[model samples]
Target: RARSRGRRCSVTGTPLLLCCYLAYLALGTSVFQALESSAARDSKEGSKSDNWTSLLNYTCLDRQALDRLIRDIIQRYKSGVIFLSNTTSMGRWELAGSFFFSISTITTIGYGNLSPQTMGARLFCIFFALLGIPLNLVLLNRLGRLMLFWVQRWALWLGGAQKNQARARWYAGSFALFSGLLLFFLLPPILFSSMEGWSYEEGFYYSFITLSTVGFGDYVIGMDPGRRYPVWYKNLVSMWILFGMAWLALIINLVISLLESSIVLCPCSRRNPCRT
Candidate 1:
């Protein structure tokens, strides 16, 4: 009777959790819309006003010519060629830059900072992604397992007995989460802020966005054409991204494990009365 009641409770819990998740999403959407919609509208109006003022001030070019020039500039920006400086020999399609793009693509980050402009390149990208994404996942899984093995070994070395191994594993997971947050989240932002000349908050935002694979593309590393970067800089960032993703996967697995354990161990359910 108890086992059947427990199973019933577990079955019902799924729907309850789903409802809660949906509600959370709705709340977030409402908050973001309330906060940003008006600001976005104002910004669009300001941009139009500025463009009109610029059109009026420029007597050398007619409106049609100015419009054509603007269109050309926008097209060049979209093609990722507008940022290239005359002094810099590096380009978006350089060998190092292409390698960075491949890493981002396989990791599913898709920063949108650079993309294949030609149809042939685009077709090749499509095929590459189909295979590369799954292969990246496999690599991440193996890296995560290797990390977990070391974490478990560290937990055992900390004197976790056979009976208390589960508790030790939980502690180890917590430690790993803390370490990952420090290494990937906290430390990297400081370096990015110093190197990219961004505010600390912006650096932190970029770090979180990139590692989470949200890839908003508002701020990408090593994209400034005006400044020279080390030849190995992009490669180093790519390695950081790959390892950070593996760490993120491990953290997600730990969280899911914790949630599952909590659900299973919960004493109070629809079928099971809470003991005070």
Candidate 2:
């Protein structure tokens, strides 16, 4: 009975976590839009030479020191020691909303809607992913199992038969295959073909190229000339890519666990060793 209750808690917790993430994304979008507008207003009112874009010059610090600092910050975020603290006064609830942003970026979601604006920040991100990628994989593996276990528990709690870990692993695999198909075959063509005026094959290829983080930028979304929708539409596309990548990593982890559990040794080889 206790196990059943625990399962229910886990199932409920997953969506609650996702909801909290979406709320954070919304807050970030608002804050960034406000900041950009304020900067634009300031630029227009000030002297022509005093452009807001010029404020980005890293003259105060030499290039070498700036590079070192960026590397340090990247490492800190990767180790989970640093978090993104919002500068604007959006209150504590909004500040908490930024945590989802931190988690996604550190995991290399690279939503592109929100990104490191400064050269230092971008350089740090380069090295941050170098160290964080493997560590992220390790954490993902553990989380996948925990997620599946909870899902199984929730099912049993609802009076369904509990699926064995092996069976759960298979289901996860099947879901991953389905996700890949939708992503690599269906979604890109349907969404991008009309916008890019490319064939369905080209659209499908573009989807894989983006989700894989190749970022060739040759066929990036919203790069199409005169594409409609405000900045918010671009942000949504970025979030979708991030979510898809997260799901891909989870599925890969499940496949690994399944393979690990399926090892076997022949009984004849063990019992007739003396005959050899």
Q: What is the lDDT, from 0 to 100, of the residue 220 in candidate 1?
A: 88
| Candidate 2 Cα misplacement greater than 4 A, ranges | 1-176, 183-185, 230-232, 254-276
Q: Tell me the TM-score of each prediction against the true structure.
A: 0.77, 0.39
Model 1, span 66-141: residue lDDT tens: 7788899899888766554552333367776687788889899998877888899999999999999999999999
Give per-model CA RMSD.
5.2, 18.8
TM-score of predicted structure 2: 0.39
> Compared with the true structure, what per-residue lDDT tens digits does model 2 show for residues 120-210?
8678777877777777666655655664566556544443344365665556556556865686458757766665577888777666666
Task: Give each model's whole-structure lDDT.
Answer: 0.79, 0.55
* Among all candidates shown, the one with the greatest TM-score: 1
- Candidate 1 stretches with Cα past 4 Å from truth are 1-22, 48-72, 80-91, 160-171, 257-276
